[model samples]
Target: MQVRNRQRLTLPGCSSSGGSSGGSSGGSSSSDNTLAAVGMTKNQFRCVFNPSTNRDVLGRANTAAMIDKHWTQFTSAASQLNFRFGNLDEAAVFFGMVRHEYGGYLDDMRENCARQGVACRQYDTCRQGGNNYYGRGPLQISHCYNYEAMSQYVGVNLRSNPNALLDANNNLGWRASIAFWTRPEFNCQGTWEAVRAFPTCPAAARAGNIAAVSQRINGKVECNQNPRPANQDNRVSWIQNVRTSCFGLPRLTSNLYC
Candidate 1:
């Protein structure tokens, strides 16, 4: 019900594509300048794009060229947020936490759209209001109702411009994601308490607490079973890689989830 002017969607914590891929004034170096233009620091840029990992979430080898080629688009989208992450920890934890899942979701949605002719029938929400709402954006937003709500929140009129979510240049992809994250109603628990302040300064940033945070984002505990959920495992791995390899942070030793 509440739309427009929501705390500027400020995030004290929480926290990117190849080439111009689309919407860029220059090449890789130009892409780097864009981040600075948007007020993102060099360290913040590295945490988001150059994770210093061997392989990305899709299992492709991670390389500087790959970063040069793809991260520009991702950074473009993520930079739409008006707020800045407080530190490297906040930025790395958030970027790592979401990169795999959202990146995977975008791929899946594109495949579904290709096969289903612009609409995915598997999700009932996609059929609402006769809008053929397929999952789009980093968070893979589906459901016509949700689309309309997001349009209002982002001031993009997504109900009519739903495909804009797929347009990295428009920055709608990340906009929809941040909107969903800050809103408590989007989660099954009616609040994303996991992202709030905890006994520690960065409670959710700790790897042990990743499962709890994932559960909040996923609305369920995914990695607790004998065979961990593929999505859950991917996200956990992403966090681990970013923390150790990219940020050079200590390993999260707690086994919060088996």
Candidate 2:
């Protein structure tokens, strides 16, 4: 059986959110300014994130106010980790990954833990707790180890309450996703490093590489495969679409595949 780690990308209609254009600003002090710097307006964000068919994910609507609230929290979390969105390219890649992973649904779940085989060993505590920690949140952060780590990083007891990652009221899902994006853990730091260094780093690693970011997110299952996994292609395509359609970029940077 194929182990589905990420959801298939389905591009939605999106329009550019005009704003400033430049490299990273080291870090932004204001979430509103950061959003503008990254060229993400309420409509663009909603176009890419809000599901067209559903009233909302679970019971929470991805409303403009909710999106603003989440974006604020996301910026705060990135700042806490000494990271920043920097530019439109970085924002495209980040949101692209989120689109591929969660498909804009907050209640999306990845069940069937036993199929993970040896990977399930590290999350024994979550299994014993009678809660399957397969995947949750915007990035679909899986495993008990990740939950414990994120709990420590966010000062939340996710180990005891993994469901909190899906709670829109507390805005833990977006916070956990941003924390995962900033920290280096999943064997690929390109996602974090690319965005983090956009301001000062050289051109080679400056704009961010979607391929490297995808590798970091799920290289074990999708990268370096014989058939060029459809999910991988979908990820790249979705990100590129976000770049051109959402942010009005001509094309992606470099290294677009893993």
Candidate 3:
């Protein structure tokens, strides 16, 4: 195991699912910022709250039971990843997102969060999808309307019962998987192959290459259609930023030392 000088844990391609992850901020004072199970002491905002190390917390032995219970509509690994991304964040963000999005207050809250999130260029904001609004699911899908639109494709009332997103099978950790394989940008040809590039420029180029792949799928040039220039703050760039934040690594091809 190679220990990074900065104690950075870079996650590329391969996926691991434990109970959850823990994060804490350094030199700051906030009750929510405390680190719990990660076995490391660091000051940084955590995406997942204090993770449970108890063997039962992850409950892998009962995953099939989890599915059979209908806790989640997803039967495939891809669908499960899609359910995890957004929910994988901190509890506050998770509560704020799911509570407003798919909970009792869904219809309006989804719009509210999306409007605030997307326009503000923040996650959980109202997003613009082709015909429906996707909002912040996995890959931060902007327009949730796509959920309802795509429901028929998956044969689930994905848009109904907002609280459904909170279900363990759904919320436990499926969102990330969905985004990895399905997003238009993610599906672009040779896209997955370039994810391991070390620095930003090449990383952005790889992202661009994927966007080009997307163009073929989209057939029309659009703003989120290509990768943004180096250091440029745009959709694809921001998406990479999120990935970087999660994995504790830089997406830049230059390996720009932070």
Best by lDDT: 2
Where does model 2 exceed 4 Å of error? 1-8, 17-44, 50-65, 79-82, 107-129, 185-206
Question: Which parts of model 3 have CA positions greater than 4 angstroms off?
Answer: 1-22, 25-136, 140-145, 152-155, 159-169, 172-180, 183-232, 236-251, 254-258
Pairs that clash in candidate 1 = 16-71, 17-70, 17-71, 18-69, 18-70, 19-69, 19-70
Which has the better lDDT: candidate 2, or candidate 3?
2
The CA lDDT of each predicted structure is 0.47, 0.57, 0.28
Reference-based TM-score, model 1: 0.60
Candidate 3 weakest ten by summed lDDT: 1-10
Candidate 2 local lDDT, 80-101, one digit each (tens): 6556566656777777766666
lDDT of 1 by residue, 30-56 (tens): 444343543343433343443332222
lDDT score, candidate 1, position 245: 47
**Full candidate order by lDDT, most accurate first:** 2, 1, 3
List the candidate numbers ranked by TM-score, top first: 2, 1, 3
**All candidates' TM-scores?**
0.60, 0.70, 0.32
